[model samples]
Target chain A: MIRGWLSSRTDLPLKGDAASRFLPWVVAVMVYLAVLALAGALLARDSVLRWSRSLTGTLTVQIAVPAGERNLDVAMADRIDRTLELLRRTPGIDRAQALSADQISALLEPWLGGGAIVDELPLPALIDVALVPGARVDLKALAERLAAAVPGAALDDHGKWLKDLIRLALAAQAAAGLILLLVTGCAVAAVVFAVRTSLAIHRDVVEILHLVGARDRYIASQFQRHALALSLKGGLSGWLLALITLGGAAWALLSLDAALMPRPSLAWLEWLLILLPPFAATGIAVLTARLAVHNVLGRMI
Target chain B: MSYAGGPEIVSDLTFQLAAGSFHFLTGPSGAGKSSLLKILYLALRPSRGIVELFGRDVRTLGRADLPALRRRIGVVFQDFRLIPHLSALDNVALPLRIAGAKEAQVREHVSELLRWVGLGEQMNALPATLSGGQQQRISIARAVIGRPALLLADEPTGNVDDAIAVRLLYLFEELNKMGTTVLIASHNESLVQRFPHARLHLEGGRLERRTA
Candidate 1:
């Protein structure tokens, strides 16, 4: 009832004068940056989880024949077969397959162009292994067994590369989080400046309301409502712009050759996560305005 | 209260206003009539005195309790501080809105009060467009429309002509008859002489009460 009366009774929305007209746009930019940061965080999280899932409990065995060695063909075949047999016999090994020559050629086609000279080089024979989920195979023991089974055989779990990938993903996520915090701080500062300008401009109105027995909370709520509305406007705009940017980037990435990089696809849940930053921005703006109004009014009476 | 390292604005002041009484606070310029009203309206606290309102010591009341007491009091300023953006009707309805009155109730009461104040035709006019007398009347309407227990007006008739001033006085009288204690502060000797209410005369921050 009171809200309806207040809305119908007055049309005093707090808008900045010409001097402060850029406040909403500033808020919009802040929200945009914040959304981007959040999106980056989400993307990093998604990429890390996907990479971890694909790499966990998986091993790649590289059987490299000595460079320029005589009769490399027979040596490579024996090593590859021995590695595969050893991997297949393992207790936790789900599947072990030696990749065909064509598959290996395709894998290197992007970096090393297909030609007679490239085909002459002695590339290592690669065996892909999948382990059963939660199956604990002692990798050191397996490596020792592989060494005994075949000379010049190595079990490469890709641990070093996986660790670096995870660290990079985590670092990107942390950086995104830091950006979000800084954006929120900037938003708070903007809100405080706007609220202070409003208070200064409407000082007489505040005094009249105070004399008429309006509580501090009541006056503060008016400011909070004003700020919330502005922030919501800015936040929605920023979110839409972010979505457009993300969509455009995804489309651009789709136009590139698939072999160049991993596909940039987001799950539906991950897309929904993009909505969080704008909402958080609006909440921060409202809280900042309320606190600013309350603190300033506290000094008055 | 005293200023920072300055002489006291009001001191040794001890007085109580009975319910349903009216008074005219008259004093020379800078004699602190407005200052006393400020203290009465809970705007200022005296440095060394206990103040009570509606039989409650104001010093003992918590901050949360002030709004209730303030709602019971209506104050009209000397400058007629009307919100320039709001219409006269909206200005008059401010207190009612703050009190959470329904929209229909607020509209009805505000319209009726504006009509009574001869502002029915100008209800939708902004304060910037209104004349000094019209603004003063609007301020008075806003202060009294909530039917507060006490109505305090500072120089209520300072800007109006003699005829309108008399009508405004009659409006204050009508509100007083309805059980609102009224206090009007003015230095106009002729106007103060016309009213037969008690006079609260101030000199050098000291108060002297004289009943009619």
Candidate 2:
């Protein structure tokens, strides 16, 4: 069966010669796409996790006061500190800290101008909070309690925007995965079509085999073996090219964020998974060649 | 074994071309002589009655059971059905290969056979490069290479010159002497008349024994 599967890509059936099915340009495109697939998978696995870790379970609370009451600041500040103390004592609340003048000033530097450009900078007071994993927070209850303690207090949960970001990332990963599957499917289909066409072109060969007492399996083996070889070659070339491209891109990304580059390593388990491309190619080849040979033979004789 | 086809090409075809038996299947064109030989060679199943060969009922033969019997019988098609891409030698070796004969065994047998058919030096040449007579001779070599127990030829001499035609008949004579049943189909009444063999003559899909 293996030999039979290998023989299918061939146009020169009677000559006992196998031809390379991988045209160089098509191989290049395959490599390019393979790289994209690998990179997309890697990003979805490791980099996405890193991005989420940096952003998840954290919130920035923006406390704003009406414009006219600037002098009630001292008492309001005291009440704000007390309310933060209450929040730190709440269950599942890991850590909470109000932003000081300097940090808030730095946060506004990008948009509100830097280095004391305005004598009186009217800015909202902000608090940062971290939540324990799998923990729930009643944001509205916290907001009501803070309001009772310091009428000027407000809580900013940051959940909605973070959820939207994570969803978008997941959607992008799914789209990339779907594209990979479609391409793999097309590659398999193309091999099948090519094999069937070659069989059709060489109808005389089939006739000769039939007359000379060759079984359908024997004839199919000759073609299928050819196809299986071609598929393996083409598939491997595509995957290797993809890996090189992904490695290069990953190197550039690591250079940009050296400390937070998500380990810059594929674990032994991950490496095993990464080795699947060539096998995938071989599988597609077998399926394509078998289908092509069997379909044509069944129909023709 | 009654197939759906109406008339038997060799109706009431009772005579066996026994071991070492030689016969000419002669009739006018479209007289079903070719069809009769097709049944004898296991290419077509006969419509009625038992067609036995090698001590097995051919009519009830399964598809899987047929190949072993078929390999024992050599057939020369009217079209000289050689693979277009294979060389003269490879085409001749095809049956041996199908029989699982090793490469060395197939090559030794095929080369000597091609040489016997006057294609010794032309073994590497493809069929398209050979003349009609040469291709016919190669087809003859392919059929007779394994020295099958039976040889069936359809218009074996149709495309050859009188000299080559005589040579081919002589080759059949050689195979027949080795205990192979030789059945030759032809319309050339003169050739049949010259080579006196038990004649199974066909006309309008009916068979009758005739002296040539």
Candidate 3:
């Protein structure tokens, strides 16, 4: 059965029409855009998940240095110690440790350059806090307690920063989704236009076939087969191009500092997900061709 | 029937072709011979009047029903209308393929029919490479390949010589002997006189029947 279907010829001479010659190229470009957009959306989703996983149960406490004080004064040191003590007493607190001045300097080395000026700068003392997993600490009450314990101290739950980052990631995802939608619409329109032009160019052939007792579906199948073959060719090329582009981008990202940027990586399943656009383009092409043929044939005898 | 608000090319005409009958549609140029053939082949609908084919009303048949009806009728167009890209064999095999015949059967049947039409050597030749008479034979082979119940030909012999036209009519006669009704529309008065079959003579959109 498969062999017979494969050997069946298209009676429409669809492949020779100048109108559909560029269909594969059009499909390739559309699939390429779709893949990139989908990849961007997937990457955004991964970044959001990774950031949330790492930052979920952590907090930071900053102790601001008093104005005109170029160094960590005794009073600020005492306040840092008090804040640490209070955090250790909290029920859900797992561990609290003040970052050493040298450690803060090392963290700033990337931007500030390793110089004696970093030592002279009045840097605030920072405390890194880890909470017990699934802890439900009240951030508002904790901030108030820290303020009372140390006049210049504040508890930083990182909620505002994480929220803004998540918002940005979500916006990127939404934009990618919109782009994918537009690409799909454009691909469909392109296929429709191509099919219509082909129909017009081969109007005589179609009429002959119709007179020979070919059903609308039989005639449409010819166009459908043509579109399917073209789309598959275009889809594969587009997918290969996208994979090359993604590989290049990932390789480029590897050169940047891991601490500075979240690495854009996809799991095996995500790579598989990225393969959908090509098949989707094929499906859209075939269905569009079939519908276009039927629509045009319906208008005829 | 009228065309897009133009004057009626064929009007107030009624005729029925009995099963297993043969006739020649004789008319001069602009006498609506092709228009009448178009109505019979279900390519055009009449602006007014009932057209019944194979026991079904053409007007009542839906778009989906047309194919089955058309499959029962085959048409030989005046222009030949051969697909320029397809080989003669493929073109002749079209009706059987459209009917969903298996490839082996399609090949076997098409090859035999092409041989009968004297196009056996030109099976692989494109329509553009063949002469007008050769194209006409290919068109006829395509029409009769599936053994349609009704065969409608518009100027099927206009391109062939007198001898070949007589031979083509004999081919049609052979098909008619096998229970297929045949209608050949031509302006060749001498050709029509050579055959004893009934003639459907059309003049200025009216039909006059002369029984054999």
All models, DockQ values? 0.68, 0.40, 0.83
Score each candidate by Cα lDDT: 0.84, 0.74, 0.89
Model 3 spans with C-alpha error above 4 angstroms: A1-8, A67-73
DockQ agreement of candidate 2 with the native complex = 0.40
* Residue A189 alpha-carbon offset, candidate 1, angstroms: 1.5
lDDT of 3 by residue, A1-301 (tens): 7346544567777777788888889888888888888898889889888988888899999998866655657778888889999999998999999999899998988788878989999898999999999999998899999998788898888889889988988998899889888988888898899999998988988888888888888888888888888888898899889889988988888887646577988999998889899999999999999998899999997
Instruction: Specify the highest-DockQ model's number.
Output: 3
Q: Is the docking of candidate 1 incorrect, acceptable, medium or high quality?
A: medium
Tens digit of per-residue lDDT, candidate 1, span A1-301:
6356334333344664542366578778887887787777777777777877888989988877766668888878878877888888899999999999888888888678777755777778888999998999999999999988887778889888878878988898999889888988898998899889888988888887887888988898887777766788788898889888888987887888757355777788876777777778888988998899889988886
Using lDDT as the yardstick, the better of models 1 and 2 is 1
- Stretches > 4 Å off in candidate 1: A1-13, A16-20, A67-69, A258-260
Interface RMSD for each predicted structure: 1.7, 2.7, 0.9
DockQ, model 1, C-alpha based:
0.68
**Top candidate, metric lDDT:** 3
Query: On residues B1-212, what C-alpha lDDT tens digit does candidate 2 reach at each position?
Result: 23365544456657767788899988899787777777777767776678889889986776667667878888999999888878998889888888778879899989888888789999999999999989999999989988889999999998998887888899999999888899999888778777879898877656788765
Tens-digit lDDT string for candidate 2 (A95-154): 888878888777666566668663276677778888888799887887787777666677
Q: Write one digit per residue (lDDT tens) for candidate 3, span B80-198.
A: 99989899999999888888899899999999989987898999999999999999999999999999899999999989999989988998999999999999998988998899999
Q: How much TM-score does chain B earn in each model? A: 0.96, 0.92, 0.98
